[model samples]
Target: MNLDSIKQSLSLWPTELWLLFITLLGLVLASFINVVIYRLPLILRREWGETNLPEISLSWPSSHCPKCKTPLSWRHNLPLVSWLIQQGCCVKCKQKISLQYPLVELAGGSLALLIAWRFGANLSSLVYLGFALSLLALAVIDAQTQLLPDKITLPLVWAGLTWHWVFSSSQMFDQAFLGALLGYLSLWSLFWVFKLLTGREGMGYGDFKLLAAIGAWLGAPALVPVVMLASISGLLVALVLKLNAKWQGQALPFGPHLVIGCLVLLIGGQELAGWLGLGAWLEITSWAF
Candidate 1:
C-alpha cells in the first residue's frame, strides 16, 4: 500500500491498539537491549585487548540460561510473561533468574507507550523512542559496570545532530550545534577543575559526550535543566546511600541520573522550567542573546 493509504488505515485504529503495538515493540527491543547491555562491554573489552573470547556478537551465541548454558526455546524467551510463567527461574536448572530482565522489559514497554501517547504514531515518536531506549541501555550498563562505551554514546551524538538538522523544526541547526559544543565543554571544564581542586576525578569523559548528545537533540536551552536535574537526583541518591552505610569511596556512575534528566526534559521540560521559575531566566537569557 502507498504511504498515504497506510497512514489513513493507521488513523482508523483505536489509540489503545497503537499503544499496545508500541508496547509490544518496546518489549521485543528491550530483550535485544538486554543482550546489548550484557555483551557490549565484553565485546569492547575483547576488542581493546585484541583477544579472542569466542567471538560473541549481539546476534551470535543464542540466548540461553547463563547458569545452565541451555539455549532458551521460544516459550522461555517471552519478554515479561515467560519470567512470570516460570516464576523467575530457569526451567531447565530451576536456578533463579535475575529480576533485571523483567524490569528492563517493563521499563522499555512503559517508555514506548508513553512516547506513543505523547507524540502519537509519527516518525518523531519512533525516533525519540529509539533515543529513550538507548539512554535506558546506557544507564543500566553504567550502573552495573561504571562504563559507557563509545560505541553507543558517539553514535548518539551524531544521531542527535542529524535528527535536529534534518527533522527538527523547533530547534535550528546552529542551536543544536551550540548545544553539543556547550554540553561537552561544560562537563569537560568541570572535570578538569574538580580534578585540580580535589586531586580526584568526579566524573568521566563519557558523561561529557552523553550530555553533548542530549544537547544536540534538545538544543542549548536544555543543558541547564538537564544538568540541574541530574545533579539533584545524584545528590539525593548519594545521600541515601551514605545514610544507609552503603556508600563506598568508589566512583558512582552518573550516566543513569543524566539519563533520567534527559527523559524529564524531553517529556515536560517547559512545564518543569515554568514550575521552577526558570522560564523567566531562560527568557531573559534569550533576550540577551
Candidate 2:
C-alpha cells in the first residue's frame, strides 16, 4: 500500500492507538489525583504558615488502606479495572473502597479523550489536556477538602504563561497574559470588597490563581463570561445544597465553579461572547455612559 493508504489503514484500525493511550493515561492521572487531592492541602497549609510541613515525608509512606493499614499491591492499584475486580474493596483487608478511585479515573480518561477529539494533535491540545486534568483534580480536591493547593494552582499558572510563549507567540500570548492578569485582579479585588462589607473571608486566594490559569489558556476576554457562568452555576449548587439540608456551615470551594466556567469557555467562549455582545454591552453600561 502507498504511504497515504498505510496511514489511513492505521487510522481506521478497530482500536485507535491514541484512544488506548488516553485510557491508560487516564488511569495513571487518576492515581496521582488521589495523591494530589490528599496531600495538596497539607502542602498549601505548610506554605501559608498555618501549619508546619510534617517532618515525615508524605511519600515515604506507601499507599496503604486507611482502614486496615495494609499496603496495597500493584494488582490492587490497577485503576478502574482493579476497582471493578475487587468490587470496590481492599484486596488485602476487604475494606470497602470509596468508589472515588474508579470514578476519578474514568472522569480523567473521558475528559482527556474529549480534549483530544476537540483539538486533535497540536501543542495547544497537549497543554489543554494537562489543563483539563489539573482542573479536574483541583475540582475534586476542593469539593472534598475545601482547599485548593498552591502547588498545583501556581504551577498551572506558570504553565499557562510558558505554554503560551512557547507555542503561540502572537495573539495567544496577549490573550494569556491579559487573561492571567485580569483573572487574578478581578477575584482578588472582589474578595477584599466582600470581606470589607461582610467581615468574613469569602474565598481563597488560590481561586484567583485558578482563574488566572484559565486566562492563560483561553485569554483575558474570557474572564467576565467565565465568572458570570461560574456565579450562576455556584448559585444553583448552593441552592440545591441548601434545600437538601446538606449545606452545613462548611464553605464551598469556588475552584469547582471556576473550573466549570473555564470548561464552558474553553468549549464555546467565542460563540457565547458573540451571542451576549459582552464587549459592546459592557461599554454601553459602564458608568461613563
Please tell me which predicted candidate would have the highest TM-score against the true structure: 1
Q: Between which residue pairs do clashes occur in model 1?
A: none
Per-residue lDDT of candidate 1, residues 2-91 (tens digit): 767765776776888888998899998998899899989889888889596657998889999989999999899999999999999999
Against the true structure, what is each candidate's TM-score? Answer: 0.92, 0.83
Give per-model CA RMSD: 2.6, 5.6
Score candidate 1 by TM-score against the native: 0.92
Q: Which window of ten consecutive residues has the lowest lDDT sum in model 2?
A: 280-289
Model 2, 7-124: lDDT tens digits are 5654554436665666577668768777667666766677668664653234756777868979877887887888898888887788798877778888878777766566554444
Tell me the whole-model lDDT of each prediction, alpha carbons only.
Answer: 0.86, 0.75
